[model samples]
Target: MQNQAEIQKLLVLCGTHSQTAFEQLYQQASPKLYGTAMRLLQNGELADEALQEAFVHIWHKASEYDPEKGSAFAWMATIVRYRALDIIRREKSQQNRSEAMANEQLALQQGEDFFIHELHVDEDQHLQLLQECLKALDSQQRKSVLLSYYYGYSHSEMVTRLKRPLGTIKSWIRRGMESVRECMQR
Candidate 1:
């Protein structure tokens, strides 16, 4: 089970879409992949989602695996890591959107008392602070951050929408978020 030869043989069988081999490979590899996902995501629910996506990808992409590029386990682990990262990013974006919407609705409907009661805010001071912080960011950063957090756009979506490199888009979102957090903390 822990042997490279066994893994490579299973991978070959998997390339032909052998159900038994897939099952066995899953049995042999799932625990390690699940552990990796859990470590990266830090939430069981998100980790589960990552693991599911990773397996779906593995099923489809098994034939594409190249031993020259890496070992079967390394290739699979890469898939799992990327999947987990994507899940975490999406979850964080969703959380940010939900919080922003709730804050807006709470401010409009119930005012600072609800913030104090529900969110433990001292006053209504923080309302619009996030918006202002967002406004302070550069255009690309602001757009990337808003698209990602407000609209739940993935990094790839942001890259496509913003017509930017993936690395640049990721940087914009990361830096923009840092700026927003810093501004809100003021």
Candidate 2:
């Protein structure tokens, strides 16, 4: 009945490449993940495609997960989110580059509002609690998570932002998640 139980059920299906379980997980999780991708990409068709790819990746990657690493939902959510970001970067890199010269003002405004207002942050109180919890992380950990979650960057993008090695960014993200998990437990 727990989330982990549901995830374990899905992972079994995934490991064995079960069609029915794949449909079940897609039915269950893809709507929210697709909506997340749509909001980030602002392109429904692309979001739909990305959602499918993300689910496929999820199926492939599910066995690598452990409940002890994080909640099934959070781990799966990370997979969906990063997959969408990857698609956007790959397909729209040129568009993004031109925004600087083409619609700088509009892009700037929308980009600012996108992170601050469009991301559907939980609430002031919840964010305050999260921020307080995030204080446990050192600066790099905080930056990596924020860049990835708020800005929708992939792990490689995070490395570019931090000017650090990929392994370092990976370590920061994992350690930061662990720190936040511990903080929330208290």
Return the clash pairs for model 2, or none. Answer: none
lDDT of 1 at 110: 56
What's the lDDT for all of these models? 0.80, 0.71
Local accuracy of candidate 2 as per-residue lDDT tens digits, 1-186: 235577667765776778788777777766777777888878888888888887878878766777677776677778778978898778776455344324433644455432324346746665556767765589788767766664467887667656899998888888898898888777
Candidate 1's displacement at residue 183, Å, is 35
* Model 2, runs deviating above 4 Å: 1-4, 96-186
Question: Among these predicted structures, which one has the highest TM-score?
Answer: 1
Alpha carbon lDDT at 72, candidate 1? 93
Give the TM-score of each candidate. 0.59, 0.46
Q: For residue 42, what is the lDDT in candidate 1?
A: 85
